[model samples]
Target: MAVSSSLSSIHISPRTPKTPRAERLEDGEEDVELELLGEDERYRATQDLDGTDGQAMEAATSKQPISAKDKRSMVLLCVLYLIQGVPLGLALGSVPFLLKEHLSYSQLATFALSSYPYSLKLLWSPIVDSVFFKSVGRRKSWIVPMQFIVGTLMLYISLNVQKLLDDPGNNVGELTFIFTLLVSLSATQDIAVDGWALTLLSQDCLSYASTCQTIGLNTGFFASFTVFLAFNSEAFAAKWGVPHLTLSAYLRFWSIVCYAVTLWLLFFKKEDKEPATEADMSIKGVYKTIWTICKLKHVQLLIVMHLFAKVGFAANDAATSLKMVEKGFKREDLAIAVLIDFPFQIIGGWLAARWSRGDRPLRPWIYAFWPRLGFGLVATLIVYWFPKPPISMGFFAFLVFHTVLSSFASTVQFVGISAFHTRVSDPLIGGTYMTLLNTFTNMGGTWPKWFILKGVDLFSVATCKVSDAGVDIAVKAAECVSDHGKALCKDINGTCVTETDGYYVVSALCMVFGVIFLVAYIIPTARKLQALPTSAWRVKMS
Candidate 1:
């Protein structure tokens, strides 16, 4: 859910002009020249040319200053992006922490499915891009309806969530289904906003769109994660002399905010009409382009790498915080740790960008890979030795330090790979190229999580100790972990006692796999890929 800022920085090339000239390449080779126009400039050029030359039009637009309308558009974009982040933050950050208290790791794994919709949204993005009602507005046709639906869904969940979570039936499947829908809608909104951003701002100030996305999305996520968790905690609320907010109340507040924003967008904000000269690719063409890109040998190799690269960190990323919570670490403390690490993530990204410059953009990523993996191992140790509740200030500080270090390394790797993505992505289809690579990268992190979580329960050894009418008896821990099993165990007055936690076992296995992956694939493949000329990454469109 925490996307790299580099994604927003993609350079989408303008449509190729009908007339072409020759230009010299850096290698002293001559090639046909393609002029790049910003989205706004392109739109203006298509309207009432009046014999104005392309260069003159470009110069005029370049000198045009930002207006009040443009500033309003920027603010609108930030709010839209912020709304998009809400469902994602709830699904990925807050819900998991809340569920871990009552649900088994396997159930939590099921809930993890909610986050996959965002990752797989790439599959449907072309459809969202290609189809829209022109009268209403290309972006608004999707954004308004999707956001409205998101608000409605949030309202529905706000009313029913408490009952669902507290139900003895263990409604994780229902929760997953509903949250999946919510997140899917959010992804749809993201697609629309991403497109709308192109024309919403002046050509000269277009780069600010990415800045808005980064700021808006991170702020929204922080509100939902750190602020929500802190306020939702009884101890934290009591300590601060504030009201303890429930998840339901939090969702309701956001739902109303979503409604307010969506209403404003529906009636107040008008999307700029797309130029008639600009033709969107048909959905079929979009799919064909993706297929063509996929067929390239370089792309194939990169996709394969993205699919498996995160396997090493799956256990640590997915289970470490939950394991710490299971060991009695308070959610408030966890939230605080995240709060402190937030700034470091930004700093790490900036540093990674600085380090990733030049020909080998992937060098920093390759360098950080091992340390990041080691941090995963270290996280497991931290969780293993996590002290009892009412933890000392010194130990809490260490935990914060570990989180900052791990997050810093992860951010470096993320930004470095994203920088490489920027370097190789074809400007003509920058959004699609970047989305394809990002989707694969997100999947690599997502798919292995459920298995890793399930592995914890699989490798764990626990037993139910029961005193049946004064006679001692033992039952399988699995028989006591489920909702029904817990009730059955309670009927017999039994307590589930964990002998060997699966966290340690799973973490160890992940460490071993990390080493294997690093030595066998990541190092060699990254080096080879980075050394390849940029030409290898470009696909020739038919």
Candidate 2:
């Protein structure tokens, strides 16, 4: 009898087909066909000597079936991601507005207060990944206790008053620190959820889950934020004798719900794999696996890409609410406008993926310079749209512009990321392939905010009203005039407009970079596809 060794699908090789044309694009889909080199090359080995062992390893790992239990876990994990958005929206974006109205701190400080916790999540991811208390029991383990801490933290904030509202002399630093601690704990819960999620979802399903997760997060956040805002600003006021609870207090109440849910998950679930220190790890350990992935060509491209993709939209993502406030849009109007825009966003993302799935080549994203140039034209037209009014509607103007551009590009992005990861995941290392993608994806996510904050500091905001002819003036005075002129020019009557320069400039810049990257991302991806050895596409049976 011959001894037989089944392929062990514990490792993966990065030999997926080159990114499809639709996926190569950051904007719309790429449209290149994978034209393999001649028939002779059909059997040519894509795995050179350097990649052969890796390819075999991948083949071993790629086909593992996800158990039904695991699938359920994965779905639950994704829901957590979606659920993540609610508290995030309430605390991060909504709190800043409340703070702006109630606090003495300058604009920059207010922004920092809200965003600090999210940025530091990386610091805790490691800890969350490593810790396991067996006595606590199950995959959920310590999550129950953490939930209590998180819940109590929220409860504390919910009942508390905003110190900034009363005495200007009150210490904002202390209040914000406490707030950050609470938020940090909340973020830790997310890290734990993602850790658990990774274990639950099958490798093949990660991208789908991620896309769903993204939508869930954004949708949850928006819904929760809206509810909170309504209660804090409107409903709370309607209550008898009670000082309408502050936004902070409402945010705390929201946390209570999250914690309660978290506790339930703890009782119901347990980790699939317990903590393994480096000493306890296998021959090819987590660090080694991660290191191998980081060294791949596509991973490098992804890292650089993380910064570039977001840099183009840095101002658009983080500053929108504040920008709207500055632009004189009422909060209520801004809220409504966003509600309208978000649906379009979700639709755009779904269409990009679903549409690209058709057309054989599956080029869902259309990233041509010509199309983007057309976008630039539309942007310019928007700037010049309608008659100039006396008051500034800069906020509304910017919102509409960003909503259009961001949704269009981001939809394509959602698709591209899915396609890219799908292409990258080795059919052999079914689950681990997804793990690598998620890790890389997280890295990509970090850069945008990093670049955005840097860009905010690097760029100066200067404004000047258009004189009969361009006139010389002090920059600050011009900026003041520009700001005031913008504020004075808006009405629901649509009768007044101002000559807006800022949004127009930003839109133009977005187009410029959009076109440049579109060209850059497309040509190489197209050429790379055409160069892949035909044998790479062959279905070789061992």
Candidate 3:
């Protein structure tokens, strides 16, 4: 919903005129022209305008305008969002599954490092917003070079992945550092894509922007997590005449893809040439405008909601993946399960777009929220009931069902929140504002995973020993180190051996937070926020 028409309000104005001028562009669409009024006219506009009344005055003046949609631009935007998801899926999805076999719970949690760049991007967004290469245009100038670097890094990593995986526990540092750099490059490229969308689409075309993003991101994730994993599976590797399944082959394949896509976007994508505005010319003005946006009441509320919405289910992804491994599920099975759920996520997104519109914009969140909580609770019960495992086929079936349901619900909720942010965002600072909101949303999801990993370690007990046969064996406890004299405990080999019930603890916590937020915050906030005319969300600078 990138389609806000708050251009008049985004500027610093003494008083709004009774009637604003509408200039016709060469494309025959009308756009607002920001102009100041004389003293008498200013007085008329400013009268009875202060505090809440000023907010009301601002809402009344910033009307949504209609413009023609561009099919080509929408397609291009989707492609850009898809590219942004590649590194994200690699960091959040692919690497976790690969590492589960080699690393302990604590080491697995460190995978969150790859996503940290997303949470911090907001801090640097003002700089991105204020400066860019003039010749190539602002957005592409940043995107092209960053994407090329990402591709080069992917290629280099593909070549060295074998060396890094040689002794994964010992090499965790090298792996984390390299992947962190890949994710960082992807995150910076995301800043450019977000900002580019504002200038690329007209106000009328904004609503579809979220739809494009959801589809594109999910598509990219599918390729990176599901498809890539499938290719790296033993069955596929053997069929394709490969000797072994390693991340190296997958990374090498995607490296080619990244480079090709970079070339296509750099050479062929056309961007609108935006004339430098007052905010665009001044660095201080950029920060000042961001400060003003931050002061708006509606903006503040949206930011809080974005940060807390995911707290309820934040740890589910990490916890569930590790639990599946503990239950004897193979990495290939996990990947395929996610692949099956991929289409459903797209369907959920489509349904959300259709249902959560008009007067009840937050309906999708409400409809999906209860089911999500129910699934989390169900997961807890399942974990509690089957505490110890030589995992059964029944457990695998149940796991698949839970993953599918949760994935669908997550997609629906994400599209709803993303659409809300799009609708409220000012086109003037589209990239910065959108990235700012998403940064909080990403952070909310991230911190809980860290807590979950630490919680697992806290409740679990594990030990290892050298057997009489001279092999290292992991076990719940040791009879006597004196018996096997060389025996000692190691974190890497420490399974969730004794305190396996920790999974339920994390699940229950997710449910608790979900219910509290839904009742205490979401229910009341949605009513008041949705009731306001979309214009009420607009920020006015004076």
Candidate 4:
């Protein structure tokens, strides 16, 4: 909701009275004297107080919008969100596979290079916020140019992957560098898109707006990843004949298409009315305001609960696909399995929409939470028991089950957090608050990647040794060399460096983090729901 009315809280004290007689008598003022303005004129459609009747004016402006035009903006922006997600997720998942398999680069290195740019984008958001393109207005200004750049890079990457791989003399490093730049550009587009989403939505309908936004975003993401998988598979058998790198090339092609569509959209989007944003929409202010919100006792528990919810997700994302791989699924097969879960997200979104129709208390929303969490645990068990099973009809069955459970958990999480954030954030800094919270969640997801990777690597090496002689740094270096290659094992500043075994390390990290989160965040969140007043959870709305 881009709507802001706190600016209307203007005060005129005894010491600072209303406009002086002379000032009030300016030529323009004579057109409609303050006294003649009347009750209705004073407050009509205003977001701020001015001239006179500030509080009285605000009361009138507080009415919810009834326009059909305004309502449709949510649906339109949701479509954009859902569409953009495909390119984003395709890039997120497929690019790494392409690099590791075709180019012989490491997945960790590729992910950090590709994905790191997105997380670091907070650095540039202020520029996006404060500055709008003079010709196209702020949102369009940033979005249009960046969209072209992302598209161009995707096309470029697709065409050049082979040339770079064919010759050791060629510079894959430059290709990676170019890819990083496009990521930065794409992330800026994300920032602008979010701002656009906020502006189009009204203050009165934030809950609905956010629900649609999440659904659209997840829908786009799921679809894009599926498309990526399908395209990757089909491309693997295509004329390019670049086996391992096929998906990456196809993803690049997809990015080009994404950029092209976004560019086309640039022409269609209307210019936004100039709105005061720094005083209203800045992310820096969120840092200060989040502290203030944290002090509320009732809300504080929800915030902690919010923090706890991520433990499962954080652990799950860090290792799930790799686990699936270890369980003998091919990358293409895994991609197909993931594609099967898309419908569950829609189901979850529909349920949330239903829940929104009633004025129910937040607790009965709790019923869905346990089943979602239980589904995750069940899926995990099934996978573990059938570890390394062939991809059969039954395997697809488990895949659907796991995906539905995962989607349910994701739905519950989205609806809960959106509801929580909407309550806590002041309308004055709502967009800023949401972005900052997203940043925290990003940290939650990212911080554990390497730690998990390293710990799992160490455990795997030690388990393999299992000797009283003790595995020294040299032994670890040898193991590293064995796992990766001799080039990866080297000495730095007279200290030994080794390439950690990725398979064992990834498994160990997931298991450990999964157990911790299962006990800590998931259990506590469950407990909170159980403790909720009985009357709160029984709303029969969809």
**lDDT of candidates 1 onward, in order:** 0.71, 0.46, 0.63, 0.48
Collision count for each candidate, in order:
0, 33, 3, 7
TM-score of every candidate = 0.80, 0.62, 0.79, 0.65
The 10-residue segment of model 2 with minimum total lDDT is 1-10
lDDT of 1 by residue, 478-508 (tens): 7343344455567668877767778788888
What RMSD, rounded to one decimal, does every model reach? Answer: 7.3, 11.3, 8.4, 12.3
**Which pairs of residues collide in candidate 1?**
none
Among these predicted structures, which one has the highest lDDT?
1
Model 2, range 381-474, lDDT digits (tens) per residue? Answer: 5444533333357746664665556555555555545544444443322233334444444433343443443343234344433333455332
Instruction: Output the TM-score of candidate 4.
Output: 0.65
Residue-pair clash count for candidate 4 = 7
Over the stretch 17-133, how does candidate 4's per-residue lDDT look in tens digits? 111011222222233212212254323311233434643432343354546755677666566555445445644555444443333213344344545555556556556655666
Lowest summed-lDDT stretch of 10 residues in model 4?
A: 1-10
Off by over 4 Å in 1: 1-78, 135-137, 194-214, 263-280, 353-357, 426-431, 467-472, 479-491, 530-536, 540-542
Greater-lDDT candidate between 1 and 2: 1
Candidate with more favorable, higher TM-score: 2 or 4: 4
Arranged by lDDT with the best first, the candidates are: 1, 3, 4, 2
